[model samples]
Target: MKPVSLLLAVALGTATVVSAGPAVIECWFVEDAGGGRLSKKPSALLLRQSSESPPPRPDLDPERYLKVHDPAGTLLAAFRRYPRDAPAPRCEMSHYVPLPASAIWVSGLTPEQSCPRALDGRWLMVSMSSPVLSLSSLLRPQSEPQPEPALITVATAVLTVLTHTPTPRIRIGQDALLDLSFAYTPPTPKAATSLAPGPPPFGLEWRRQHLGKGHLMLAATPGLSGPMPAAREGAVAFAGWDDDEPLGPWTGNGTFWLPAVQPFQEGTYLATVHLPYLQGQTTLELAVQKPPKVTLTPAPLIWAAPGEAPPELLCLVSHFYPSEGLEVEWELWGGPEGRFQKAEGQRWLSALSHHSDGSVSLSAHLQPPPVTTGQHGARYACRVHHPSLPALGRSAEVTLQVAGLSGPSLEDGVGLFLSAFLLLGLINMLGWAAAYLATSEDSVEKVRHSTFLYFSLLILSPLPNSSPEGGCWLGGQNPDLEFTQTCIKSCHLKHAT
Candidate 1:
């Protein structure tokens, strides 16, 4: 006999143990030749051997064996026969248990072969209807040994997360794209593959969406780009995977997107994303805004109607939200040429326009100069414009009055008073002439007196300067001629008296 065993099963040589634990199916059985030629006949015959050991057979298939099922729950399969050279059996199918030390086969030939097995479990010896392992008669472990399907190649149940790290927070008006992935082990997953129970990177719309949604819109292509819209009210909902209706006990998580906007304002904002399979969420931040603008109007003291007198002007002012700096100034045009005049009792020539509504405002008055008297239809007005740039402000106008009063002439008073002076001088001249005529006893005395008065009288009106020889004189010489004539006339009058 020789050491015979299955093709891949373990084998034993001469002097191996007589009793051993359940053996792997052996293809070759070692048996004594008994001086007979080999027999090769394929026949259907079933046999069971309740022996302590398996008899060796060279005719069996390597590593192939049959199982025997009993009405009870016991299971049995073939094992390698020991002794390196055990006697072979001639039957096709035989059930056996090796016990009683080396005693295995207990056909009716040897009741001494019946025995018990090692490992303490009872096995029935019977011919099987089907192959147990390669065939379908036997059932393997059913329920998973752990939560997920895992191989026991390694001793420990180590699980490395073989998916993308959780997603990050997304911002408003921003088309930032993110790729989710991971490297794990039992061995790391291959590239671009995801777990069957959860989403691939592109599952949730809130994390990503259709082209231009109410908020955080999608791109023309798969990722964010191409005319995307900003998020509204800054909100969004996150969930892993599609088609997760009512999300059963399967797997994953739900997340929320807090508000996010672009062109950030000067404040704080928040955001969230859901990992359905992981049963959790992620967060992010953002800020948003725009700038401010401003404007003006004018009112001057006086504004003339198209034809009426110019009315004084009035004014007002205001500003816009987030107002910047204020620029202000004024100008006067298309009006009477007059110096600016203040009212008798006012400090500021202009009044400020008042808006209780909190606006910027201001105004002034122009005192028109006197217009020509009796001059009709004099046209005059003043236009005070503000830096109301881009447009001309309202104007203040003034109308000149032409009607006036008439008074006494210059000569009326001057002529009356001048004539009175001439009359008084003439009366004095006559009085002196008459007194001379009345008092004169001698001609010489009367002439002297008359000449003096006549010369004095002539001096009343402007006359040429007098001299003695060829020109006139102040003394009683030629001056005596008029004086003598006057005396003779006056003397005759006195004689008549």
Candidate 2:
């Protein structure tokens, strides 16, 4: 194929100059991958200007561009500079080729950067018929469709770029000669089924080849047209890197992201940028997805006896994304105070497994301590992490309750003993009441003294509802004591009747 430098000479208006000066032209060859998609990298060609002398311009204009013409005088490709005075600028360039032989009809796009205020660059997308020499066409009649001749059949310089700012403008040129050597590759098979599409990766590549010191000749194959160069250097830019020119790749580093946007939204987003010079633009299609679901199932804990060994508490985390960004943690919370802590040590074990449906499962096992002073009731939590989750992680909790333990039974025994003692005290009080009734015939002062002694004994006893009323009687003034004694006498009379 003819080198693109010959095309740049006409595109940059450098053909008229006696000595082509400093310029940089980077050409990218792209093949159509169908369905509005282009191959990740160019298959056929890459043209890059040598970094020599005359440093590149720090600033760029929207007026810079490259234009190409075919041998038959037909406009083939055009690259124009985009205006970028604002914080971000948008620029677009495209090429179209109609080749009926290879059955490849598709448009190619370059990776775009939206915030391209830093650098100036261009993208040249060239498409033509592959399998260039189709021998079967010569035997077939002209009635049917025939493949169009290649734009540049033989190696020749097509473009010559000149730097404008520097005094001796550096001339960037390329001269290529087709070796007539072809390597055909079979097409790869596509998958029958596919899940939701994700953000597609975009890439670009450029390369240059150095031929030997002697000049190369273009082969005279029929149906080929163009002014052939007398020597190899004239056909292409043979100038290599000299000490005076800067060294490095044609395009520089780059980074891109949509403004005020989220990656979760499903749609195509365009980002165009230039490092030091323009390479191209990129479009990404983000797929909308739902966050993974987290469910926890804990192992049952049963207690049959007071001193039985503690049981194993199992926690299962289910329904999580399996793409390697998941973190599962097990935590234990216990006691009436509800203090929580991470589950650790040799007794706690955890494992993560992948399912056939692309989801993940996590299982955590732990042995709880025996019914100690504070570990009676406990809860276990499973936390699952995924990129789609809104928070750090989604969690599920399970409470563990043990039954039929001796701790509550020991409490009930203490309560029963207290109840028996209270019943015994009430019987003793009844006997004292009978003895007082039999001694009621004594003199008033003597009965008062004796009754006081008996009542004081009753007050000291552990009788329910007796101590407070007896103490009040003993401590009351004369009038208060007389009122209580009268009321008691009336109660005795009613009992005798």
Candidate 3:
């Protein structure tokens, strides 16, 4: 008899001719017989069905095909018979001894016959409903094989293989995408051309809707351009197929795309996909951009009360991105000219921060100039430089004013006292002049001494540059012709007397 091609069951009593030429089903069992060495006994089997026309006969007798082999080149079973047109009979086998062997059935078989055989135990059973084949096995007590339906119906059970490697961290405000590549292998025979390594067209949305859940949120397109497919819920946009179309299990290189990841949504995410023969999962720890916030403040001098030591000013940088790149500076403005520097105080210091939250701060003591009078208020400032911020950087400034006892300062007070004394002397001299005008001309000589003395005091309002003793010289040089000569002559005569 020639090798036969078995037609898989499409429905209860229907047959399916593979799109490819024909179909074949195979089953095998193996065992290790002993010591480090094992039994070279026969274990594998093969079944094939024929599509050629049958010869004229009383009853239709389909040709049969079967082959069996082992490492020792042994044949366990070989036979030929006509395929049963009606529903294949149902048979059951159980309580068989466990052994180091394996049984595999492949080709266009129904779901009932496509189940995986137990890999570890003892007992073995097989139920053959079609002229094709069936098989089973056993292992240790660790795990038990679940019971499958006794009928060999349609093909089911596919394997899913997902491939994903860790990608670079995603930056904030930038577009990001998560693509999960996938493939599926149907439970068909290895020889079936349709059983290639590829994913089916199952709606990615369907998979997500059923198995998808987490804190991860999906956003609409971020307007990014690249060779990667546009992200969609049901399937990969670049898959070259519609979202809802169902593809064969063999063409398994399908990719499912998640929604775009937002900048604020940063965390580890777990993604899992379940397919017929296999299931796969991967963990993605997402990174995001967080700009730093800068603050300028003064540390407590001593709680609510002032301490012996002056207060320290601080420049605090918080919530920064790329934590390693944080930088801070302190400056003082207001002195001889409008300039600033970091050396005005006792110390220009920055405290190191080891926090994972990406926040850092700088601190230093505040020191005001010693000559605080008459000078304008001193200015304190802080500057923060970070890549996340502008090139000019961010900064803050403050002006501190120190007031003296005599108004704003002591210099103003001395000038005011001098102006008042000058006014009083001028009034006295004018009174004396008026009194002398009422008296006789000859009497003027007697009061001349008093008049000159008052006039001299008023002229002395502006201090002499050379010496305090030169004050009298200033009095004699007055621009009034009457007083310039009279006052000078009287002082000379009085000193002579």
Candidate 4:
């Protein structure tokens, strides 16, 4: 018979057709002949069934035909029957369509049922049910003659990953459960149009590489040896599709769960999926950050002289990984009630020091504004920010202590010097007037003694009190004039002697 358009509509509950428009019904019997080689042979046949045909026997011998399973693990038997004298149908090799095998394994349809209008009223129905076959069945040795190697189609596939964590990047101490969906796109648009609407078939493999450690396989079970003992806890558990437990509207999707992320899990993680004829991979980089330890140096109580700039505020951030996101913010709390404000005239100089242990230390130096006695007790805070820190960040603060000037002020020293000079000149003029009025030697000596007493009193009166009793005659209510009185009394006694 001429090659007929075999619309292989196996009876699924929904009665879906596999192909249409003059397509040959060819079956590929694949068997693994050992040594990583797959033997695939094609057999073509024409199947015809009438509405009056008897119900299919439930006990068809499974060994008479090649058994295959759909993506749902449903058993399907492919066999051919013809008269003993008839020539075998010619099998023409067509490009692999990449369609889902499940669409070809429909059930629950009878010949009496009308084919879909898209099929143009030409179709065939078959009923062959048996126990679901494992994929290993395809590798078993067949009693029939071995066929040629199967055509390996190299199609591009898209790998999509959805992480369950709140952040796109995984943090340490979090369990990383990834839902991986692998879909294969046919090489040509024509083949893509023939595919069923569902996820493609594939297997997953995980690999990781740490900074110092070499590449290691991350198995889905425990007790495997790798770079880090913590990574061995990772395992890949297959999430099979469940019609009862619907995951949104997607069907035939597969999920793989990675291990709980540990503190030591750092480096690049690669997830590769192996489709029947295609492979794809994606990578996730985990730097395994260490939270920065912020410290502000120079003590909490900083002492600075009035009208002088305060000491540099040193904000040291240590033991942090990946030095890119380090930030230091300086704030001043000095206004009424100590309101918050950014420190003015803050010139921050930063330097990053890399350690041998893959951690970085940042020293941020900020020179605060000049402070006066009025600004004493002002607080300067250094807030550090890093990727590992919380929103508020880490902070260290210091209170300003504006100290008084160490020595006498210029104005005070000048006033004291001028006062002493005028007092000495007046004493000289008085002594000269007294000596000129009394020409006697005793009178001159008395004037000279009075002059010496007056100068002595002036010199001693201005000195601060350092006596054990903490008392001084110059501390009287009228100290400026009381010293003159004391000096006069001493001078009179000296002159009488």
Give lDDT per model, in order: 0.29, 0.34, 0.37, 0.45
Q: What is the TM-score of each candidate against the true structure?
A: 0.17, 0.27, 0.27, 0.37
Give the better candidate number (2 or 4) by lDDT. Answer: 4
Q: How much is the lDDT of residue 17 in candidate 3? A: 21
Can you tell me which runs of candidate 4 are displaced by over 4 Å? 1-161, 166-202, 207-216, 219-270, 278-287, 336-338, 345-350, 355-357, 404-497
Residue 280 accuracy (lDDT) in model 4: 40
| Candidate 2: regions farther than 4 A off | 1-103, 107-281, 285-293, 298-309, 334-338, 345-356, 402-497
lDDT (0-100) at residue 459 of candidate 4?
67
Ranking by lDDT: 4, 3, 2, 1
- Candidate 2 vs 4: which has more TM-score: 4
Top candidate, metric TM-score: 4
For residues 384-406, could you state the per-residue lDDT of candidate 3 as single tens digits? Answer: 77766778788766654443322
Q: Compute the lDDT of residue 396 as modeled in candidate 4.
A: 89
> Where is model 3 poorest over a 10-residue stretch in terms of lDDT?
69-78
Q: What TM-score does candidate 3 get on C-alpha atoms?
A: 0.27
lDDT of 1: 0.29
What lDDT would candidate 3 get against the real structure?
0.37
Provide C-alpha RMSD values for all models, in order. 42.6, 24.3, 24.4, 23.6
